[model samples]
Target: MKHGALLRKISVVGVSAACCIALVGCGGTNYGYTGGVAATVNGAEIQEDTITKYIQDFRTSSDLTSDDDWGNWMKENSFDPATVRDQVIDYYVENELKKQACDEKGITVEQSQVDDEINNMKANYDSDDAWKQALSSAGLTEDQYRESVEAGLLDEALEDAVAGDAATADDSKVLDMLNTYYTMFNGAKKSSHILFASGDTEKAQEVLDQINAGTLDFAEAAKQYSTDTASAADGGNVGWDAINSFVTDYTDALDGLSVGQVSGLVTSDYGIHIIKCTDEFTCDGKATSLSAYPQEFVDYISNIVKDQSKSTAYSNWFNDYKAQADIQNNDMPENVPYNLDMTKYDNSDSSSDNSDGSSNGASADTNADASATEDSSESSNEKSSDSENSGQ
Candidate 1:
């Protein structure tokens, strides 16, 4: 559960990045998706294709294609149409999931119970003004943030109802499950590959034609042919990678290419595999890593363990709850990655009052930076500069 590991767990969607940016209100922007599948939960349509679009956008936004098992890495961490759901479900599900679980146990959350929770959360903010500022950064109004806090209480209540003895629960188990669940996740492997889900090499071949024709890009080709689904939308972006970091097919095919070199279509179990040597790096970090993105790696590892150790009871309780729950992912889409577009909400802004009458993560910044410069001229100029520097 290191931040390095969580790096893969992160949605690389361009739209997701936009949303992350949205939370910052750094010259807030409003971005939207022209198309993508809407999200549906229990037969209720959530957002029509908005989920898929967000998933795709988030995947494309991140520059994190670096891994030894790039193909599997992308597959495991494929974007979830959960930008909205992803953000909102924690509150909703934890609320309902907890409510239903607690109702069975006849346990009620008293106003006093919730009051303490709110006060505790407020304390974490240092002061009233500071708390409001933090909420604003997250695009939440005070009321909205409080509702989310209440939902946390509900989630806790439900966990107690179902799992029993909130102490000594299963945080490690959950983190372990998270670590083991996907190749693209914390399991640790990254690769570059081509996808042939088109059932034939025709599409992959077309990519080759483009590369050969000097028009189609290798990273873009990987994005186009990568049947890995999740990373495809990102044009096969692999981040912080090294040699032998990918599948055998990838490493073998890549032997002839130099750094930044893209190869012809090479076939793999997933589909056609293409290798791009974006970089050559060495891994020299310690075994320790953050449970999630190590935006502050040392601090997280240093403090998290002691905090969890003190909450062993809660962790144990969670373990039992998850064990008994009849959780299942039914009706998984064949093109699961297609169900989400990470960028659907990118650079788009929306402001609404939550039940508590507070605004939630709304920004109005529009497409100021969307038009990233073309790679050719910018890349060529940079390369020329590098060569000049080298010669001098």
Candidate 2:
């Protein structure tokens, strides 16, 4: 994801496949290429155009425009075009391998499924123009987009087949898995804070005193005095998230309170805070029988639990294949010329809460570090959403 987040921003249009030849020189030649073969995975040649189209697709999805925009993104992310191309090549190699596995197994994606997916995607836009604009932004033609969707469907199907009965494990097992992931997937709380920050304890105490005496509202105190500028503007509304997303001290204090209840002075590395819980939700630490839930609810959670297996199965297959495959990549230069310095980008604003009630990026829960759980769960959650919404 670290590479993916940055690679999504940088791409080149009209760059020749010969550019790879010129850039890598002779030491990196692979598969004895004569026809712009970017790499070969298990004797299957991944064409240069394949990686190029993917680059363009990434560019479009990120809403980056023109050579200048891409150049600026390169400068911002400290990446080179060659490195971006190489990353795409690697991904394409993996994708082709997966496709091959699907083919070898005689797994075929139906035309109706692909058609339904395309229609559903089109419906998300208000007009054909808007849909076209989206495709243009993603550097994809209608046909190419359809191919991508078909590939995605095939990817899902392959994963499902590999993951086997784990998708519909008994309610107790499903619950255990759910309980394991709940801290990551669903252990979130919404709260308003009045963060005093480090060295502001005196002021923090003053604000707390005012709130206790009913003279100053928590929201007013947050806007007027909290040092965390990002959430301070929202009246210290940190939105919803698992408590463990923050430092233990901070989260422990938050965990102790009931909804709508205010806490006394609390301290953390971020500084002191008078805390108040706005909304709270929790899963029982224990898993219950399927009979305890509605059929619809059981079906829904069952789908989510199963979704986790998809990527695992795909990865296991790919890893095994890669271990034995005759892979020859011209993408990697001996010295690896690109300088990828991640600290240059502002990741502070990365958290996004979707209309579908999914929140990603930094937890808006506390203005603390992004949760480790969030990172691991986000991709699987997206996959799950796509699978669920495939025909809608």
Candidate 3:
């Protein structure tokens, strides 16, 4: 199982951008706050100061030097300053519950593990200054970052301990899953297609006619006329993806075809497609047997089964533990700094800037583990500068 899955509720930002700074002070013993408490998880106080610190650190790391920057960042991320305090508190509360559960199971993270995680994060940058800058950008001190890593490690250990037998599957289970999918999808099919622009039915029909007449080769027709450039370059091969992975129309057209059979002109949201079934895995309409499938396909299905087993195990364990835990959230304190008055910041100038402030597409509420590695060079900033640019 992925360690990130264990702490999804606690991670409030992407790793490359914020390094998951929200996780600070989430593990170890209680802070023993003398100030007002934000929450109480099984009689352990989550201090109001802790919530304030999280917001302050996030603000500092995001380089929100002015009210305008803060306001714009909030706007871009759809953050409601009024409820951010409650969100932070809730995340900490969940983290505390996980930590407590780990403790109950005698799960402990060694300091060396925390150090190694930090060292791995440091390796992602070139110099000490760059490392420090990343920490500051994440709004984390080295010590606080260590705490986050420790919490993540503890959560991972807890998952393994609790999941136990549910994390594995026998060969019988794998075959059963494959049989179900095969019966539902009428066995798997692989296809290649020649695509045309939407509404270009005349052009699509002409290409189909040429291929049907035996004058034009299917692969050559795809390479010459298909608009889906990525698949077209490879003779329009969509490969052996699961049936559900394709659009409804594509899958419907593919389902009716036998091996080496060419489909009539099919239309979907992606535009017109002339599909050819390259391969199939049906054992003469018998869904009970896998003898007809290649060993490679069986192996693929086995891995998927194992992954699903692990995920289901983790989910079941966490859900049960959380449901039984004594989690109590106190009301929000009146004087918390999270409630920012947007009226003070001039929105007219910064409203048009769609950048989420960070170079990566790190939002104030996204999942990232402490040990997560990401290439800083290739960020969402490079993919598309304008948030409105949703590429086809």
Per-residue CA lDDT of model 3 for 50-164, tens digit only, reads: 7766666667666664566667666666665656666677677767878788778788988888787778667657788877776664455677667767777787787778775
The top-ranked prediction according to lDDT is 3
Model 2, 1-392: lDDT tens per residue? 32232122222122222111111111133322233667887777776655554445445444444454454455445456776766557556666777778888889899999898778667667698877876665445677566666766786688777766544445775666555555544445667777765787788888888888899998888889877766777788765433223556656777788888888988776677777888765555454655533343345456555555544565666688778878798653333222233343334333232358554221111121233234334543444422112101
Q: In terms of TM-score, which candidate is stronger, 1 or 2? A: 2
Per-residue error at 283 for model 3, in Å? 15
For residues 183-223, could you state the per-residue lDDT of candidate 1 as single tens digits?
32322223344456536778767776777788976667665
Model with the higher TM-score, candidate 2 or 3: 3
RMSD to the hidden true structure, all candidates: 23.9, 16.6, 13.4
lDDT (0 to 1) per candidate: 0.41, 0.56, 0.63
lDDT of 3 at 213: 94
lDDT of 3 at 359: 34
Query: lDDT of candidate 2?
Result: 0.56
Evaluate model 3: give its TM-score.
0.50
